[model samples]
Target: MGRVTTEPSAYHRRMAEQKRSAIIDAATGLFLDSGYDGTSLARIAEAAGVSRATLFKQFPTKAALFDAIVTEYWKVEGEGGLDLRPGDLRAGLTAVGRRYVALLTRPRMVALFRIVIAEAPRFPELGQTQFKRGKMPYFTSVRRYLEAEHEAGTVRLDDPELATTQFLGMIADYVFWPRMLLVDWSPDEASMARAVDEAVLTIEARYATSSARPA
Candidate 1:
């Protein structure tokens, strides 16, 4: 068959994505200001400037909207996935680490986390939803990257999950976890860069196979 014409569908898809983003942004702000329990879909639709019918069509329930907010917030840019070469352990992880830092440092991301922390007690499912739907995908990507590196003979990791924990935890403890407690816990670019570099070196030291080791 000849090349298919996709112009109309692509235009429609772009419009749908734009509307979805608006809905998510409106709902996220409302959830932060009003708490998940206090915010309603009608208000979110009005704030987003979309029709209530449209909002309902996109997100039929408040929980679903919250889930979308959580999932969409954590999604990495680009293809929203790790696109690392299989064997270049250091370079790949440096990219991943920088991406993680970028994710953590976004203002809306911090606010989103704060919203989850503040509202989670009364609305425990929000916490579960954030962890399950938002956080785990990113976590799993790192773990799977480690696993792939091992398979590619780039690293020798028996416990990819633990390795993932160690790698991400090191950087998060320095750059992210502190911000959760200290409102003014922003690290300088040099310091965050050092954190990522050091984490990569540590993982490489522990896990790089003999042939993968530096000459």
Candidate 2:
């Protein structure tokens, strides 16, 4: 039998990915605890058990690391996995609203929001990048779902984009904002259900066709 040898490049690539994951995990905790202005690459490297040179090789800057952390959070949090189903528009929208509220109101996500808000003035690009990468994709997906519903006669909206925005805003104002602004304020299941129900009802009343509405 011929001798087999593993490729050095493949081994290096796997190690790099493992290191990146570790770095992101450490950075997420540090960023959540200390906020963006308070976290440094040295601290993250030490916490991640990597050298500063290795951390720099992966992220290059604090903002870049923050961006990676936000992206990783969303990926693990299932923000990219929301999909509009074929039946029961109201149920689908309600589920989406509830999940979105849950994600935004979670402690870690609220901490991320605080970090972004606090550091946005100093690192404006961080805010922009978070919106472009983290927030906009979900919003765009919702808008597209609404548009499909409208075209399918499931909803009757003059503007699907505006209607989608309004639907999200309803939940955000009712559930997310309070939790974000008040550390002591956490919505119980009843409150979350009520908010999501109201948001679904409002959207259905305004946009869903009579046949598409829940009985």
Candidate 3:
């Protein structure tokens, strides 16, 4: 009978985490260089200086690895604590709008969106997972601010989810679907800035109540 290895110690666990982070970074570089479909597990393992077996031990499948990369790449701390006070609805929405614009304009973020959209048909749940962990958190963060405004009688949103979706849709429209679909022209800084400004103005116009209007 084969002898089973004992569980890793706390120190070993930390070291393992470091290795996994390194592997993910290496995989990200490869994914960006060769695209997800072009990149292979062996290539990632070689790049990470790990054996194929070790890579599998860390991430069972390509989809699993991609999902981890997606979540980690977009992950932001303190997003759950977005300030939702009752004053300056336009300013508050603009802050959130700019953050979204920044995210969409990032090179890595654009690449990630392309990868996910291309692979989404094969992996239906991929979109759902990304939406749940990535987009949902962002929406929830902004929704908290919206809810506060509603409670304070500054905004009049009966359905916070609908409001959140509408606000995000405005930002999405600025990305230009043809460019996303064809990997054509990237948004310049000036264009992105204008888009963010317009999105904030639109959302505020739709949702702001008397008290929340900018003074």
How close to the true structure is residue 160 of candidate 3, measured as C-alpha lDDT? Answer: 92
**Candidate 2 wrongly placed segments (more than 4 Å):** 1-22, 32-38, 76-80
Cα lDDT tens digits for candidate 2, 1-215: 99787766887989988999899878878877887778899999999999999999889998788788677655524544776664578877977887777667654777677777877898898789789877787788788878778778898878878998898999888777776667788768898889888988988888888889767
TM-score of each model, in listed order: 0.88, 0.82, 0.75
Ten residues in sequence with the least summed lDDT for candidate 3: 75-84
Better of 1 and 2 by TM-score: 1
Clashes of 2: 0
Q: List the residue pairs that clash in candidate 2.
A: none
- The C-alpha lDDT values of all candidates are 0.89, 0.80, 0.76
Candidate 1 vs candidate 3, lDDT winner:
1
Candidate 3 per-residue lDDT, tens place, 85-142, comes to 6667777787777777665665466666666676678766767767776677777878
Clashes of each: 0, 0, 0
* Model 3 alpha-carbon miss at residue 115, Å: 2.3
